[model samples]
Target: MTTQQDPSRETVDRWAFADTVESGSPARKPGVRLGPAIGAAAAAALVVVAATVIPQIRKDPLGAARGTVPQTPTGAPAAQAPAGQAPVGQESLAPQQTPQGGGGSLTYANHAIVGPGGACCSTSGGAWTAAGTGGYPAYTGPVRTSADRNAWYEWNLGRPASGARWDQIKIRLWIPQAQAGAWVRITVTSTAGSASNVATFDVAEQEYQGWYELPATFTIGTPDRRTGSAWVKLTYLRPYTDQAAAQACADGSCDRMAAAQAEFLWS
Candidate 1:
């Protein structure tokens, strides 16, 4: 025979039966925690967010902070100036670039077509004259009447390719009936800049008459810079004779040098 159950106890028994039915699986233990499942879901969300954010940081590190974006200009010309011109100078106006190639070219902001400097001779047409004979329009490679009688010829070699290097220079000069050899200096320099690459040639062979290429090729330019302005100086290492006096005569005037062209070579 069954005993009659209390009403409050019967109520508690019914609630426990409901919880077991909701869980459904008999293998599921009671009082298991939901906190681990919630934590795992949050960690997965953080990984997804990081994947999207890292690329943005790399695309532009300062874009977010600077509030400005950098973009490559569209439809810009490959070269600013025409094929045979250089940009306006940060200093003076550079001359037009020579259109021809094969390495012999001059491009400068402002340049002097080589002329004779210092007092030593007379110039007429394309030759320097001293004594009774005339030499090619050239500076008198003095024989040394004094310390200041050296001859210097200068020309403005245009600026080099923005980053291009000044490799070596090939120069052509003439020496007429010489009693002895003199010292010739090829100096690649910048205006108001110290001497860059300087190469010297000794013309000892009196047989080296007429236009002869300097047997010694000069490698020019300062370190990583262009040979700003190019100048050539001729001084006597061995005393032979000075001709400037014969050309200067009673007047201190002289003629122009039209033959001296110092070339710039680039890689």
Candidate 2:
């Protein structure tokens, strides 16, 4: 499920100061000048013009012109529309133990993005560790991001763990109630090597009410099976996005705990 907090409805209307005409007030009649009579008439005409235009200018107390208002990133009024896509309002999808079509082995892994000195940019969750063979690097609890949007918590399913003949699979997740939209992304990959085969999906924010329980599934089609890679990777794209989104609902520390508990199950 995705969420959105509409600022217009939420934001308090600000008070505006009324404007005064810069030119002299019309109450001051044409001054008696040392010059000719024509000069006096010209001064009177100027006052008439100011009187006409100043009233129109004062009509727009906020300084905005007719038919114009500040807009959002996408050409629509920022006050009325959300940035990028429209806000998601539905509940999170429910968890399902059984895969859509059924029958497959499943494994789970956890990762966080806290880097050197613990900046905590995108990382979430508690400590994580793995045990396996075939030089498959078990994804340690917190993965690091280098601006590539490509940090992953990897898992392996070689001969012993996964039968070589099984050609189809599905992946699911336990998304936190708080990070419904702002900062979370989901991605899947077919290789542990540098040039990994991959797929990605974006999660959006949801409305405020109750926590969301979403279960997402993806099919490993025939083509992916033909490639012959022995490992799979699940990544939390832009974990910071998740942090920010979830923070909207809860405190930063609370949000981190929520994200850490997020589960990734495959079948």
Candidate 3:
């Protein structure tokens, strides 16, 4: 009678034979031979599985090893801007500067020509022949004239635009001929109640001839004074002297007067 061998022992033997074949061993045991067809089918199945899984592993080896794709933490903070810098799309809080005027020559709104003896040259200074004739409105003392005669060219500058402040004020004068110790006094008045601001400029000798600039300074206040109240006066002080009278009135023509031009700066 054939003895029924242990089933567990047979299974162990079959596995041991398969391990030997995988290790390149050509030896086989009697009655424990594996079928050639079965071995080929198993190898084909392994090939199909390797073909499908190896490409995926090659694509993402780290993810395959970790068994999951890497991800950012949901609670991580976002990037921030540098210190003292505004964020994107944020409005700036710093003050901005807006400058106005100073484009061209400044125009006068009102003018007055006061001749010697405190007399008005015309009913309106604008109607005078020498009001804007590009010549200085001046009077010369005759020889032996005792009184100190003076002439004035008063002008009112237009008010600065709303929300604008004065930056600088400059006056240009053309001195055709020069005289010894000849000078003009410039006075600026902002309001009726405010004191006048004065500056003296010398226009004597050849060095003082031609175009000369007279810079003047005055306080317009923090909020500025009332509009249409600012004015400037150019006074030609003619003192009676032998030398001045002889030189100025010798040719019967006092060409020592100046042509005035003014410019205003604002911001």
Q: How many residue pairs clash in each candidate?
A: 11, 15, 0
Q: Which whole-number lDDT from 0 to 100 does residue 252 have in model 3? A: 32
**lDDT, each prediction:** 0.39, 0.37, 0.41
Candidates in descending lDDT order: 3, 1, 2
lDDT of 3 at 1: 11
Give Cα distance to truth, residue 239, candidate 1, Å.
3.4
Please report how far candidate 2 places residue 111 from its true position, in Å: 20
Candidate 1 whole-model C-alpha lDDT, 0 to 1: 0.39
Give the per-residue lDDT digits (tens) of candidate 2, residues 42-64. Answer: 88999999998788789886545
Model number with the top lDDT: 3
Better of 1 and 2 by lDDT: 1
Number of the top-ranking candidate, with TM-score as the measure: 3
* lDDT per residue (tens digit) for residues 64-180 in model 1: 435553333574433344455544332234555884444333332222222233232222222233332223445343321112334444434444445333444445554543422
Cα lDDT for residue 73, model 2? 65
Q: lDDT of model 3 at residue 4?
A: 20
lDDT: the better of candidates 2 and 3: 3
Residues forming the 10-long window of minimal summed lDDT in candidate 2: 130-139
The TM-scores of all predictions, comma-separated, are: 0.30, 0.27, 0.33
